[model samples]
Target: MKAAKAPQAPEPTGDPAERLRELKAGLARAAALGGHPPPSLIAVSKTVPAEAIRPLIGAGHRLFGENRVQEAEAKWPPLLAETPGLELHLVGQLQSNKAEAAVRRFDAIHSLDRASLVTALARAIDRTGRHPLLFVQLNLGREPQKGGVAPEGLEDLLKDARNAGLAIFGLMTVPPAAKEPAPYFALLRKLARRHGLAGLSMGMSSDWDIAASLGATHVRIGSALFGPRG
Candidate 1:
């Protein structure tokens, strides 16, 4: 007998609001398939300008992800000031020197992958009196060029984060490109379970449904919501 196939998620089409609806429905269906709660969607607004993001914000999308500290600082502050309850997330590599700036601006940091970063964030948190939710990024594919901590070094990083007073809320991973992502998502889920971490920040426009079904708590979506960048 042929095995049952997983449901394919619908492609997000139309305007931003309609796209958001489709994406949310797809995520809900994926969550049902996995027997887990629907994951939070972080509409990745990295290079998209404020004009483009306003519609989603008007449609009640409060969580957004940015790649750089400078860009976020330039774009979000006024928008966030006008729209209360908006949560900005830093979804790219964060330099230790920018820890203070990151702590000040973002609501969650998804790239806490090294000892120096942990120490820097800890000091920044203490100095600013702000505590953003943190995620330990794991280099599941063991890519040298990536920003994630190696699987073998994750425990040590976690230990350092904890000792430095940073509360690690989850694990995040970017699967190797040009390949299937489900296995990586499953591996991340297993790693989180082993470490007693509750959140998994995996998935993107291409494989978010797979990530959701495998137990992702936060899915970072860019093109699906905002269209392709220039």
Candidate 2:
């Protein structure tokens, strides 16, 4: 049998708009190879200033992910007011204390990995009437230094979130660094299936093509779109 080929990574060059186009094209090709629809691209604007992000916004990209609530609070409001149909995703480790603010500011939250956060976010959702799409970040590698919930604890967390009426969107993970991400992506997909969730917010600038091929519903891209942080 012929070996399945890998999709070519997009050249990480050009302006933000061009880079986004290239990235989307690459994602589409990978999805085609895997017989899945193209995943949504979340231009990770963490640490990227609004000026640098405007071009992508102007180019019609709306979904953006931010790592810090404060940074996003400072940067996205004005841009969102200017650009209609914008959606902001909080893609970092969220504090239980910041649940209200995060609920108010972000349209989606991708780091729901604990019971405390689940409770806090559910309260915030009720208080603010904002129920952002929530994803359970799984620590597939079970690294202690990471912020995700270990695989063994995922079901309990999911139960807590559901009991609190928080809509569980899907699963997200950042595989151990310097390792091939395919296995990790496949694992996340399998877990999502088992739990009856659909979205998979795996993949970053480095391994998004692989993530897309494995049925990612959302792929987060950062440095590749905005260049290196200053």
TM-score of 1: 0.95
In Å, residue 206's CA in model 2 sits off its true spot by 0.5
Best by lDDT: 1
Name the lDDT value of residue 46 in candidate 1. Answer: 88
**Candidate 1 lDDT by residue in tens digits, 86-179:** 9999999999999999999999999999999999999999999999999999999888999999889989999998898899999999988765
**Model 2, position 23: C-alpha lDDT score:** 92
Compared with the true structure, all predictions reach lDDT values of: 0.92, 0.90
Model 2 ranges with Cα > 4 A deviation = 1-8
For 115-161, candidate 2 gives per-residue lDDT tens digits of 99988998999999988999999999888999999888989998898
- For each candidate, what TM-score against the reference? 0.95, 0.95
Q: What RMSD does model 1 have?
A: 3.5
